[model samples]
Target: MNDMEEDGRRTTMTTTKTRGIRLAKEENEKTDVRKYIPPLDGQYVEKWLNDSQNPGQVGEELVKQQFLLDLLHSKISARYERGLETAEIDEHAWQVQNSITAIKRRLKQLVDTVPPVVSLETTDSRCIEMYEEKQLMATQGMLRADILEERQRVARLCWQLHNTGEDTKEMVNEDPKNDEQEWVERCKLEEAARSALLEEINRLRSTCADLRARLEMEALSNEVPKYDSL
Candidate 1:
């Protein structure tokens, strides 16, 4: 009777082990399927397609096409990462991906596009020259506008200071303590003016940096020949 009980226990243990192995294999297969599948953004595509109420608006249709293209682009990238087979990847898929890439390249040409965060500022003279020229043009335009405004402001401030100074002089003759208090007030005003000037100078410096960056971008765009056009 004890021998029969032992045999029964061993059979139960084996069955449990087999079931565990089967479950693990099933889980692994599911994981493999998930790994092969690509993630996608759907809302972006919808927004692109329905931006305009009228179907006649060409811009909306173009935008919709671009969104679809972007989706295809993402799909292709995901497939590549997932190791999709050439034979498995259909011609239609490639066409959509190609269209997306082509449109993106054209869009880049029309605007001063922001580059990826990883692209560092190049140290090469030609690269630097490109950067500087764009920066200079953008900066000069901004600076000229700013300088004109600043000149007007400075004239107004000077007139205000002159008027305040005359008022202080009159107050000093009326009372000695009043004169001292007026002098302190004047010092405070001067300090505030100095601080404002410093701030303006800093702002100009920042504008200069922005100009330089814009110039560089413009220069780079011009210098780089388009192989597609060629």
Candidate 2:
């Protein structure tokens, strides 16, 4: 019975040892995938090689993990590039919009700074009346000046005639005592000078008449006719 009891305990001890070893192996297997290549990092890809079945399988799996990582990296890089392109397009669109707005603002500013040209014609009787009045005043002034100049010229001619008559009367009184020939020659010279002066006065009168006619024609040409306003 003692030997049988010792054998039963030994059998129990062996069974427990076997169960513990199996559990420890399962625990080690749970951490094995992490130790192989870190699943995502390919932690030691160079150290893995196909030397045996186990190593070969690990190498193959590591390569697959590396390929998966590279594929994900490529996907992220492509998305980053697309994002950059989209940002640039948005920025360019914004710049174009700003340029259009600036151009519109500049065009408006240029338009605002320009002055508009328009005709000045008006149908106002008051303006025409005022212009006619100004022309009448000017014509009256010119006529008065010409008449005054003519009057002064007539006065001078009268004075010269008075002097000549006085000299003739003095010569007649001295005719019996002085040379009649000298007196006759002096009268002739005086008459010639008076005739020249008279000619000059007539010429001046003609010039004044022509000037007045010209001024009237010019005023008539520049005059604005009266029209009824609407």
Candidate 3:
């Protein structure tokens, strides 16, 4: 009876060890199957790859991870390039603003230093001196033309008077003293008109010349420096 009891205990011990070994082998197989069965998080990557023939391929996960990494790197690189470009533009804008400010200051100084061309009596008169000089020359020209025309008329009249005097002396018994006095008076009138015309012409010409010289001086004074850019 003792030997039979010992045999039964031994049999029970051997059965328990065999069952534990089988359970451990099944659990390991289940864990390995879980690796092939991708988690929900990786579903999108699987669908994108769409390799239906080998859905459980080991390299699919590695390929998806690499693709995500490359996309992220590209985005980062683009952002960095954009930031650099923006910085350059901002720097250039700041320089432009500074240049504009400096130019404005210089322009103000120019305005203050240069006298205005116009005055109370002369609207648009910055070039008034030049305008007046031109006017004077024009007037002088008109006066000179008039003087020439008058001199021609006076010469014609004098020729007519000489012809009349010679005809009188030949055709009629004339009083010599009376004839001589009339001739002298006629000659004096002609000389006086000629002298007056000549003097007026000379005065106009002189005034015109002086005005032209003054206009040139005023022009030099009015000239101011001009800016093309910065």
- Residue range 1-230, candidate 3, lDDT tens digits: 99999999999999999999999999998874544443223324334334333323324444444344345434544544454333443444344334333433444444556555543454335346556645654564565466557657867987997898788867765677987898799789979987997798778667766666576656754763333332
Return model 3's CA RMSD, one decimal: 42.0
Flag the better candidate by TM-score, 1 or 3: 1
Candidate 2 lDDT score at position 44? 35
TM-score for candidate 2: 0.25
User: What are the per-residue Cα lDDT tens digits for candidate 1 across 1-230?
Assistant: 99999999999999999999999999998874533322223334345333424433433334555566555545654664465643333454455444444444444443325442232333245467746645654654565456556666777988997998788776636567876798799889988997897688768767777766976676666756433211
Clash list (residue pairs), candidate 2: none
- Clashing residue pairs, candidate 1? 130-216, 131-216, 134-215, 135-211, 135-212, 135-215
Model 2 stretches with alpha carbons more than 4 Å out? 1-122, 173-230
lDDT of 1: 0.58
Q: Which candidate gets the maximum TM-score versus the true structure?
A: 1
**Per-residue lDDT value at 189 in model 3:** 96
